[model samples]
Target: MPDIVEQHGVPVLVCEADGVSIGTVQDALDHLIGAAFTGAEVVAVPSPRLDDRFFDLSTGLAGDILQKFANYRLRLVVIGDIGRHLAASSALPDLVREANRGQDIWFLPDLDALADRLGPDGAGRKTG
Candidate 1:
């Protein structure tokens, strides 16, 4: 189950770190759709809950999952260290860097970093 918490004044659905990892596009869809029902604008997923394939740029799973979130206009935040994965993939680091610059998706180190980026009171911010 995901927890719905207010971070920076935004209703965010934070996925459990020890929960099942998202191994397929359907899994990603399920999480995104479920979060929508909670009226959450952002879904914060810990890196531990992401499929290993999602970190392999060759798998295309990451792109597909991200596309689904973008199509649904849902913001996704992947929290926790992904240094090892990034170190292995040449393209992933660039992808992560680019994603971080956008508003729709972000790759952060932790919830605290997310709070800082969103500010103390995340108000007047566009969701997706």
Candidate 2:
């Protein structure tokens, strides 16, 4: 049972897995909401290794993970080397690209990139 850490005073849940389950999301939401989270932002799941399979955001365990996020309005970030994913399916590549463009879902290359993009350092670094 991992606990959420306060990153810059924001509750951040570092997912130590391929993807998160509904139970995990519920627990996280409970923690954040209990801490008075405004639902505007949330912890990012820092991982390059996602649950097996992609494209269809329905059925299977991966779908369960996606559905949980979709239902909770929770922002998700899959930070890692997704080149393998890109090579596997064009739909996944497109999904990743589209998700990266949105504020809620992101497929970043790494944690530094995520930190820099989120401006967590308060240095006002430009997000590329």
Candidate 3:
């Protein structure tokens, strides 16, 4: 189970690095429902837990999963270094750049970054 923690006043579900791998759209829905039931406004998933295919934009897995999360108004943060994968693809960097600027899905370097994005001084932005 994901550990629910309050970050900057936001209910966040922090997924362990070794938790269930998110390899399919169903997996994304499962996580979304879990977060919803727990009253979590955000979910932080370790990058290692994401399937390698997730970084490959050609697979459509990333778009599908992210779209589901966005549709549900759930914020998803992918935490970890995806430097190698970013180095492997040209289009992916563009995707990451765009996602980082959004309110829903974010690709961050660490938990600290997630906290910062949510809010730095323990006052989180209202998630609606």
Error of 2 at 72 (Å): 1.0
Which sections of candidate 1 miss by over 4 Å? 120-124
Q: Positional deviation of 94 in candidate 2, in angstroms?
A: 0.9
Deviating ranges (above 4 Å) for candidate 2:
1-3, 6-9, 17-41, 46-49, 55-64, 120-128
Report the lDDT tens digits of candidate 3 across residue range 27-56.
Answer: 878764465567888888999989999999
What is the C-alpha lDDT profile of model 2 across 51-81, one tens digit per residue?
4444334335445555666677566666677
Instruction: Report the C-alpha lDDT of model 1 over 21-94, residue by residue, as the tens digit.
Output: 79999988876556566788788899988989999989999999989888887888999999999999999999
**TM-scores of all predicted structures:** 0.90, 0.60, 0.90
Pairs of residues clashing in candidate 2: none
Ranking by TM-score: 1, 3, 2
Positional deviation of residue 75's Cα in model 3 after best superposition, in angstroms? 0.6
Cα lDDT of candidate 3 equals: 0.83
Q: Ten residues in a row with the worst lDDT in model 2?
A: 31-40
Alpha-carbon runs more than 4 Å astray in model 3: 120-128
